[model samples]
Target: MKKQPIHKIHIFGSVGSGKTTMAKNLSKVTGIPCYEIDNAVWIRNPSVDIRRTDQEIERNLQSIVQTNSWIIEGVHTKDWVNQSWQHADIIVFLNTSYFTRTLRIIKRFIKQKLGFEKANYQPTFRLFLNMFKWNKQFEKVDKVRFLQMTEMYEEKLIIINNRQDLNNWINNL
Candidate 1:
């Protein structure tokens, strides 16, 4: 099957749910730039560890908004993030299993620390555990919210519960 061309894509899901990985892959396949929300939201407080700040995050997101074409992926999709949906041609909601995503998060942490993931820096276990929060709370609730969000907008929305289905869409959609 011929893959449907994607112009501007937005990937949103629970943490450790492969939002970044899948976004990067889609960007490569479709030739779109992939933007990480972490770059916008995090600041290095050398005195302490790197912490995410709201001001820095808003600024970073504004910079990305200035761009022409890109794929932005994150777990935060509140009103502040409506800008992404405003410009995106396709919005993907990854609903991968909690257990699978948890494993991915753990492996991602190890890989990032070991230089296999090539993250800007390593994240702590607290940050990693936040995935559970997203899975059990935010994403769980947002799953219902996104349906309502889609009703208010006229764009392509894709929801995937498993990786195989997502992979099929990757090649077929």
Candidate 2:
């Protein structure tokens, strides 16, 4: 059966590719519960670098699967995430340019500095450096790996390459 992903949507992309924003808007549009995977995986400083225990992560993900509807967004593409690809009805890959991602990261930093967004409690300089590292590594590895890994998978895999006419862009999919 050709399934429609009105329920489980897994959105992945390079940093600052607007996965969170897409999830938020899609959730509003579809009325499906959206879980920011980062929120589940991270607990912030003084708590633990990776928040969930193996069991905890499994349980959390299991609950989402059991619900039969979810939208997970983040950069962590573990083996388990590949398994997530199997069940996902829609897999959205935001293949944005490095320059765009870089600009978005800086803008987000400005938002944090201006008290518009909560500083996820990560140090500014280290986070900035980490983003640079990710930006470089992402362009070189992630997309190629994603294409290879998902070559045979059956899902509505979308590549949002450009930001122009987003609605038209998405509608084409």
Candidate 3:
């Protein structure tokens, strides 16, 4: 069966789970604008991230959601982002394995450090180390929260466990 066209898409996952990649690809294929939550959360600083105020972040996100069509991607699943999920026609959760996410995080750090990849934050060793910690924290806390929250939007939620699942979903789209 043909898939319905998606207008508002929200992609959420743990760090290094390829949310940004998938959002970009969906934007390209669907002709929808993509909004990265990092842009709303952090000020552009070459050396370190200076986070925007909570009000500022919410304002930015609200602006994006006010648009007719958009794809929002981020690892953030906090209360502040509940509106985005509520507005979404589809919500994607990239539930990639811990091993895969760890490797991707390492590879991404190297690429960003070498200037081969564009990143939201500086490719500092400190940031790289923190990714591992963040990953673990997400697994222990955020994962359960995501699962629970998704239950409320089960009809719109799509969980991609691996690259094959992601590819198939995109292909169907």
Candidate 4:
């Protein structure tokens, strides 16, 4: 018997938890297209980012999942994302450390501010502060909620707490 190739993947985690990095890496190795959930939620522009209508978001998500292969990454655990999981072959929960995420937030902000990194929205001081708040909220609230919601999908869920674990999982794939 042989293992089947993964076609659809969903990666969820707090801000700066390396969800995007993991998704991009997996997509690179597997030749799957990677998408950011934030992109589905927001209409990106040079001046400002506008929120997409709920229907629009749903339609967009549906279009992506209807494809043969994709890697979707985000921290969003709302009802809108439920359908993605339903179609996913695997769901990855990145349980990165608070300290590490905090550090990455700062580094990412600096890079984005200095034009070394591209961002969908402007990296303002307020947004930088909000990232920390969001990180805390994810740890305190969303993390528990996500765990509860994902209980039904335990068979396909993979929780990676550190780089070694992530590396090992990717290697096995």
Candidate 5:
């Protein structure tokens, strides 16, 4: 079968669910620019992270979606981000395992602390702990909420739980 042309992809998941990785890889292969929703939410500075106004975020996202093709990924699922989903040709929800996300969280923290990984913000212990909290909240609350929100887009939504399945789906794409 001929592959469908994907103009826009929205990928959302918990902190360590590989959303960024998937977006980057997809962008590389498809020649689409990958965007981080976090960048839309915050103006990153070495000393401080400033939050963007809701209007600013909306305008930023509007510009991206107006482009021909893009791959936007992040954990944001609020109303402000609903426009991205509305414009997406595909929506990927990574329902990664709790145990796996936990492992990735620890590994990411260590790598950031060791300067092996580049982080958008200072990787402090508080933020490291928050990753765990966010992950749990995502599993307990956001996961269900996301499912409910995306039900209207069922035909375009894809839920991935493991690396193998993700790889297969990517290969097929």
Candidate 6:
């Protein structure tokens, strides 16, 4: 079967769910520019991290969506990201197991701490601990919220629960 052309893509999931990795892969396959919402949300400072103003974030997001085609990935599912969801031709939601996500988080932190991986923020012990808390919060609270929000875009939403499911979806694409 012929693969459908994707113009705009949005990937959302909990930390360590591989949203960025999937977005990068999709960008490579589709030749669409990929934008990380974290970049828009946080202003990278070498000494300390500062957050962008709401207006700034909105403007940044607007600019990305205005492009001809792009992939946007982030764990954010709040009102700030509603526009991206509305503009997306497809929304990929990674729902891997909590165990898998936890392991990934540990591995990712190690990679970032060792400077083997590029991260939007400095990987510190606080951030490392927060990942676990965020993962739990995501499973307990955000999962239901994300499901409810994505239901309106059911036709465009694709949920992948495991590596095999992800590979199948990408291969079939």
Candidate 1: minimum summed lDDT over ten consecutive residues — where?
A: 44-53
* Counted clashes in each candidate structure: 1, 0, 0, 0, 0, 0
What is candidate 4's lDDT per residue for 1-173, written digit by digit as tens? Answer: 79877899999999999988888888888899999999999998887889998889999999999999999999988888998999999999999999999999999999999999988799999999999999999999999999999999999999999989988998888
Whole-model Cα lDDT of every candidate shown, in order: 0.74, 0.75, 0.89, 0.93, 0.91, 0.90
Pick the winner on lDDT between candidates 2 and 5. Answer: 5
- Runs of candidate 6 exceeding 4 Å displacement: 1-4
Of candidates 2 and 1, the better by TM-score: 2
Q: Can you write out model 1's per-residue Cα lDDT over 1-173, one digit (the tens) per residue?
A: 67555677788787777888898887877787898776666664534446556666666787787687789988775666777777777888888777887788788878876777766544667767775676677556876776677665644778888967787877766
lDDT of 3 by residue, 1-173 (tens): 77776899999999999889888887887799999998999889776679888889989999999888999998886677888998899999999889999999999998988889987676888888999999999999999998887788999999999878987987777
Which has the higher lDDT value, candidate number 2 or candidate number 3? 3
Off by over 4 Å in 2: 1-5, 45-48, 51-55, 119-123
**Model 2, range 33-108, lDDT digits (tens) per residue?**
8887666666656543667775666666666766778888877666556656777777888887889999998988
**Clashes in model 3: which pairs?**
none
Return the clash pairs for model 4, or none: none
Best candidate per lDDT, number? 4
Error of 2 at 81 (Å): 0.9
Task: List candidate 3 segments past 4 Å from native.
Answer: 1-3
* Runs off by more than 4 Å, candidate 4: none
Give me the runs in candidate 5 sitting further than 4 Å from their true place: none
TM-score against native, each model: 0.78, 0.85, 0.94, 0.97, 0.96, 0.94
Between candidates 3 and 5, the one scoring higher on TM-score is 5
The true-versus-predicted C-alpha distance at residue 34 of model 6, in Å, is 0.6
Q: Give the alpha carbon lDDT tens digit for every residue of 22-110 in model 6.
A: 88988887799999999989989887789888889988999999888999998877777888988998999999889999999999999
